[model samples]
Target: MNFELFIARGILSKDKNNFSRPIVRISIISISLGLAVMILSLAITTGFKDAISQKVIGFGSHIKITSFDLNKSFESSPVDMQQPFYPSLADSTGIRHIQVFATKSGLVKSEDQIQGIVMKGIWSDFDRSFFAKNIVEGDLITIDPEKRTNDILISKRIADKLEFNL
Candidate 1:
């Protein structure tokens, strides 16, 4: 059918003027509003999810290293005890920051509430200051290495669940 003939047979028809009234305008507005809301909601939700993921992935090193022997744990420990001195390990492999860390499983006891958490010991380089922007609590690593600052930086989720003040 030709374009003008098709439209004339429908809305422009003498018997069909009622079909092209306010109802059609309302339906068009409703569909446009629905689409606008859906697109806006999706954009906000995806943006928030991406921002959260970036913060988490940025807080750690790109890669890690372990030993060929003594498969005890992924806990942070002295590099000497953790790995055999391999000469080739000195190569940066394009990573910006390379540090050794150890993890120790422990239960955080705050009054009657107890939370099972892995205490990660890392060099001062990997301390909270490295993730200061994402950190929502107390001051970043200000303590000296000689004094192992038992100061642990917990995630926002954990802090809220445990009712931790900051």
Candidate 2:
């Protein structure tokens, strides 16, 4: 039977003194609960995905430009920091800034903890306003040439894994 006809029958069954009111109440409750669960799942999934992706995008520039040849080897190579145009390509492109990056894959060693990770070294001119906005503790990592220490800013997930308070 069609859905509308089925519903009419259900209503008329009760009106005609059939003993199915309790069953109809249960069906209504089950349908409401199912819809509630589906809505809750969609809301949580959308919110969680948006929050996580925004953090990732904020930590890194929206796009990057590099010589395809230089990036092929996946090794660490420092930029000269003397030239202006190469690093300022993003500025010219109407973007905020262009940051040079070198990636190093290695194991991080602490007194009581160790972890494997890839560190992306950003150039001195790379504006860190994006990171500063998302930092949870300590301080944002500044790329000053004179103060190049071994300290690095890590994500909250890494901090949790390492048992660091940041």
The C-alpha lDDT values of all candidates are: 0.68, 0.74
TM-score computed on alpha carbons, candidate 2: 0.66
Best by TM-score: 2
Model 1: colliding residue pairs: 75-102, 75-103, 76-101, 76-102, 76-103
Residue 114 miss distance in model 1 (angstroms): 2.0
Q: Evaluate model 1: give its lDDT.
A: 0.68
- lDDT of each residue in 1-166, candidate 1, tens digit only: 9997796467545666576766766886899999999999999999999987776667655555654656576454445744554444556475455565777888877766888887767775563545776666776766577786657778777777678895
TM-scores for all predictions: 0.64, 0.66
Error in Å for residue 137 of model 2: 2.7
Q: After superposition, which runs of candidate 2 have C-alpha atoms over 4 Å from their true positions?
A: 1-14, 66-97, 145-149, 156-166
How far is each candidate from the true structure, as Cα RMSD in Å? 5.1, 4.6
